[model samples]
Target chain A: MQILIIAAIICLALSFFADRGKTIAGIKRGGVMLLRILPALLLVVFLVSIFIYLVPEKVITGYLGSNSGAMGIVAAALIGSVSLIPGFVAFPLAGILISKGVSYTVVAVFITSLMMVGTLTLPLEIKYFGRKAAIMRNVLSFFGAIIIGLLMGVFF
Target chain B: MWKILDNFFLLLRETIFFLPLMFLLIGLFDVWVPREKIERHIGYGSGLAGMFWVILLAVAQPGPLYGAFPVAYILYTKGASVRNIFIYLGAFSCMAIPMYAFEIGFLGVKFWFLRLIFSLLVFVSIGFIMERFVGEDFRVREGR
Candidate 1:
């Protein structure tokens, strides 16, 4: 926490030096941007948290738990692709799944895909990188995530 | 209606807690970090140096993948190397300085180290593969 504070302070100081008279205005502008986006980001987080709290592990495990086989992998990947959970929440969720007897492979797939592939963000990616590159990257990442899961299965 | 109201309040709370700091960081980057400097470091046709520059950019960047990934895609189409693509993805995943700070705080130093190592390995490997096989044509139809 202290380190975070320090890092922020350093960034602020650097900005001051780098921008001269603009630093203060820049920060104020940033604050305004935050004000605009914070509501949406927070709302999403809260909804996800609610889902985490309210949904039983068994329910999720039943659908994509390790024992579900190929279907499980597909289910896990799909879930991961859609869900935009933060890393902070993702780790604990993985722990919960493990405790609930979800397969480590499925969990690995889920987490890997969650971090790498973003179905929800596809349009933005396409707009930014072009359709071909965006699609290719996501497809490759999807496969790569599965490969990682398989490797985890073999090793762990 | 009640559930919706409650959700709204919850989201408000989270935003109030986290967004201020994030916005400040973004603001700082916008104000201080010159576009020319970033371009020189990671711009089109920059090659390996550009890749390093992007990694540095990612290290300093804040926010979720939803926003970052698209920007990366744009950069790639605009002429960033596959290596730089890898660096962008890798840095975005685990190396953002703020993210690193958070990871250290929550998961400890060892976890952060492992994550950094793993992320770099994965990204570099992907980059090498893309460069070797995909070449420059990896992007969608050129000339928009």
Candidate 2:
């Protein structure tokens, strides 16, 4: 934490010395970007909080909780692939699910796949990477997410 | 109001603690470097240099695949090769300049380093395969 603060301060100081005008401009621009993103992030967090409060841990566990077996892993991965929750929300939620008895493998697969594979974002990916490239990357990432789950199963 | 205040404070705490330095670097890049320079230097085609440039951009950019997906779509539609796309996504998934700086701050250097290495490996491996097998016809259709 101290290191990060020091780094930010140093970066800020360097920007001040190097080019105050540009530095100020960059900070201002970055601030604007943050503003644009923050609302969505907050809304998601708020909704998830409500979900955590309302949804029974047992229900989540039954579907995706730890004891869920091979089918559970597949279910968790599929849920993650489609869900667009940000990492901030995903991590805490995973913790909650785990406490409720969801397997570590299921949670790990869900989070890894959530970050890596994106069936929901496929159109955009295709637009950028081309159909073949986008498809292949997602397919690979999908499998990769599973591998990560299996690895966690063995180690954790 | 108290709850709102608490949430805001929590968010502020997270931001202060975890925001990556990479973000600042990205800000610097945006402010100091010209977009044309990025494109001219890293613009599509096959080869090691192109791949390197793609990785640089991916690492530098922050945000989820959604943001990059559109850009990638645009680039591919315009004729960016499969190799470049692989590089872009690879970089995007792995590197996040601002967020990473924050992460290192909050999570520690070790975690950040591991993530960096892991993401790079995943991206590079994926790029290699796409370049090797994916055909060009799949390139983004022009202007659509």
- Number of the top TM-score candidate: 2
Among all windows of ten consecutive residues in candidate 1 chain B, which has the lowest summed lDDT?
Answer: B99-108
lDDT of 2 by residue, A1-156 (tens): 677667767877888899999998877776666556567756655665456556766777777765667889998889888988765445445644555688777876786688778898888666655677678889888777676677666745
Q: What lDDT does the true structure give each of the candidates?
A: 0.64, 0.66
* TM-score of candidate 2 versus the correct structure, residues matched by position: 0.72
Interface RMSD of 1: 5.8
- Point out where model 2 deviates above 4 Å: A55-76, A86-112, A124-133, A148-156, B1-29, B32-35, B43-45, B69-81, B105-108
Question: Where does candidate 1 stray beyond 4 Å?
Answer: A10-20, A57-76, A83-112, A120-136, A146-156, B1-19, B42-50, B57-113, B136-139, B142-144
Candidate 1 per-residue C-alpha lDDT over B8-122 given as tens digits, one digit per residue, 9 for 90 to 100? 4654453344345545666776666644566555655556666677877776655567656666666766767766775587567646664454344433455456545555666
Query: Tens-digit lDDT track for model 2 on B1-144?
Result: 355456545544555334334345446556776545666666565677767777666665556767676667666666666777766875775465655654454335654565555556666777678778875455654324
Docking class of 1: acceptable
Write down the TM-score of every candidate: 0.61, 0.72
Kindly give the stretch of ten consecutive residues in candidate 1 chain A with the minimal lDDT sum: A88-97
Comparing only chain B with the true structure, the TM-scores of all models are 0.62, 0.69
Error of model 2, residue B68, in angstroms: 3.2
TM-scores of the first chain across all predictions?
Answer: 0.63, 0.68
